[model samples]
Target: MSPLPTDAPILPLSQTVSAQRPGDAPALVAALERCRAEDGAFAYSAGREIGTFRIEARTLNELAQRLAGVTAVAAVALETGPIAIQPCWTPGRLAEAEHRLGSADGGTGDFAVVRLRIVPRRSGEGNIFETEFAGPPEIDALNAAVARGVARASAEGVEGEGRIIDTRVVFIDGAFHPKRSTPAGFEEAAIAAMRAACRTAGLRRLEPLMEIEIMAERDHVLPVVNDLATRGGSELRRRLAQKGVAIAAELPLRAFLTYEGDLAALTQARAKIIGEPQLARWAEVRRR
Candidate 1:
């Protein structure tokens, strides 16, 4: 996920899917489908896919506030109990709450940090949000940064080790010394650490992914087929399969800016972007 744009309004982004009660996504998905057939006016990317993340929080408001920073968090909603928070918040206050976001499932093994990334949603300002939680420096910095951002508007949060931490990186042990320059271990470590730092910094992952539908004239089918055959740099999860050939792909909001329009152009302007990508066993289930 990219950093929040300096000029654009922050859109809601997230990586917290489990935040919703079990089965909530499926129920919501079914409901949206019904609405589409009956109303035919569902906003594209409305039904967002949810990614599960852990955050340590005593109340929902604390979670919501920090989430507002990562650039991904949308309007915070309560999953199990009523969510209570102030209508408005500041960057400084959110920083202190950095450590508050822990996985509802796992609390980073006593480590105060977690790995995370911000994902943009389909609607609103398209700001980025947090995803996942790891440990150590990333978690530490994120926790500190969030408070700092919030402090820019509210209270002074705990200051983290301002300098970049090296432990933040991870190495995918290539079995036994093989090839390449350590496989970007430093970069990977930094990302994991950065994400953790974001979570700690108060950026909550809201599990926001985009759902795109492509429709093109019959004559344009050939190009569409060709693109589908060769489009490989990214991961595309096709959510719906229209036997008639109108293709639908559940694209991760994490990387849409790169080719969002390009994909549509290929469809001959006949594309119809649907709701947000919802989390599932398989992001998209398509038949050939």
Candidate 2:
């Protein structure tokens, strides 16, 4: 199983199912039919006779629990999706973060002047890595070294809370002795400078928002709406349905994690809720 994209909208719960043996297709299909009968909300499409089957569910946990009893199934895997990370930065917050790393021979050291900033990119704009340093030393090696440094810092993170996501690391200025400059020295310097810059610039955490719809009886709708409000839901709209009322709203994913159980308890197991991740927005830092 994998986490879905934080910004994805209306992502249905999907899983891939495979049989244990080549001849188990018939058994697998029968077992899957049983699962589908038990929960009419999900549907599956046939694959190659011996290939995997794809299933989508409104409630994955319930479906998975039922699938666990299907002896013909060998494995079930959830479809993966994109992850989101937004780090806020400003020029005022960024300083020329500098670092010096001495050569192995103890010669004059390499000094790296790096400017790291979180220039927020439009969705899908990607990241930028630029170098303006001119050198007798190979520029490609220096660039590679700088890249390694940035990658290491990104993976390690500024304070270990979360890895640095999308950000720009520029080698705007630096000094490298022709004789003492080495890729290793420049790499170390870049890493140190990147971390220093991140610490100085600070970080802002953003959490994903989800669009959700809840179905509850007329008498239970008000209580459900109130509960959603307490969980930071917004833009609530309601409409009459044949069986009940449907309420639609946007809510932070964190607050919505336990909503299913809470909805059951609140409506005496008579309410149904489903959601899809929408966009992300700046939020107060909280542990996941």
Candidate 3:
């Protein structure tokens, strides 16, 4: 055997897919170990409670196949959830330079005045809800209203593009009328304020980026490369391998979703490709 070329493509694990099954810790660990031994590039952590298996793989398809194998052996079921692309506007960034303050008033006599703004937060920091409204029952109501506003804004999305994520909704300041403002009034004000803020923030939709690698016969390399180019691939790198040519690129998850079938047709089922999520980047909003 010969050592592989230094520049040969190495598929790095970029995404983690988790599946839960009813099993004991030992059984889950045993199943994962078998998979790890078979799949050279594999990593996972299994827990007893529901047997959560966090499997890291180079592509979503590969992840699914690996999970299927484990589930078959462990008698576990796979649970799937919705995958979403979120829109966001990071405050103080040049992209959001057009962001303007948004405010609104609601309730009889305009008794509840709410001012709010949306700003980006560090990934995994979750959401932070803040308010400068004053004390007790009204303040509590204001807090709940702020939460409702954020949820509504997230659900409605920016111009119906998608849900909002990785942002903070701050109730910068607001007024409450002791007699005229009701809890329902404050809730109405918050919801309206959130809508206003999202409209002015100039939010951009975000999509996950994937780091991908493809290996193809030298004769088919050109066609594969062209196909990737049309799919919006970037940061491309190619090198000669012992068996064929290896190519690597960064592509958006959306663009790569249907690539398996396309690649098969293009290369006559002679090419192999794998990809995993790398990071998220601002994406152009889809026009209806």
Candidate 4:
């Protein structure tokens, strides 16, 4: 799936869907219907299909903080409990918590660091908290806990690894202690709760595929169609006329951008093209 602008806000589904030109995107509608058949939900906003990476606690804290570094990622949300905190958090108590968690360093004692940030609701109705946790580099104690929690989140219906769907995090509760509260201990609790809640929320991965309708001269049609395939484009349907051919195809979002301009040049500006986003399957990103 394509990433959204990292600093941009995610609008609610209702509003986003409402803004779309309903009947104009039959391919998108069909794709979404297929996703529904697979028990998936639409998670589009600002003309892009949104996907989230499930970050386990074993990864470096630097990696956690660098999630936003991906240029395509519109924003990173810490799915803590019922709260979905965005990167553009307000300067308040939640921000304070996030800053504190981010500044915490590991290596001195039996400590773990969990970065937290306060976020507003997608509807702009309210606020909730989200956080990420990390433990010692050499510890295996928290691995099972993190896995279990991620599994729980997946069960709750998040578009784990890959899929065409909505994304979110859920939390229930966690335990901590002043004397013996190890970072590993808190991390286990956090991961589990977050994952379970994600399932409950029904987050699914949705790949961003472009549904393009193009009309080109009869002679140029063969060359045009061949070009599309090389860029991961798949022809879904085609229509022929006296002088031109009208075809619909699905292509990866990134490939579509470059091909759009190329199509114009290939057709000598004779091709008519219209594109809309459609959902495809989810793809899990296997981390090393």
TM-score of each: 0.23, 0.54, 0.51, 0.33
For residue 6, give model 2's deviation from the true position in Å.
18
Per-residue lDDT tens digits for candidate 1, residues 93-138, read 1221122222334333222222333222232332333324334443
Score each candidate by Cα lDDT: 0.32, 0.58, 0.58, 0.39
- How many pairs of residues in model 2 come into backbone collision? 0
Q: Write the per-residue lDDT of candidate 4 for residues 1-288, one digit (tens) a residue.
A: 112112222211121121133343443434434433553222322222332222211112322332222211322222211111111111111121211111133333333332222221232232222223333543334433433433333333333222112222222223233344464554545444443333333332333355778888888878877878777677788898665888887765556546767888888888868554443322221211
Q: Which ranges of candidate 1 are over 4 A from the true structure?
A: 1-211, 228-244, 252-255, 279-288
**Candidate 2 C-alpha lDDT tens digits along 72-142:** 34343322222213232222244457776654445455544444443433333334566777666476687
Clashing residue pairs found in predicted model 3:
none
TM-score of 4: 0.33
- lDDT of candidate 4 vs native? 0.39
Report the alpha-carbon TM-score of model 2 versus the true structure. 0.54
What's the distance in Å from true for residue 17, model 4?
25
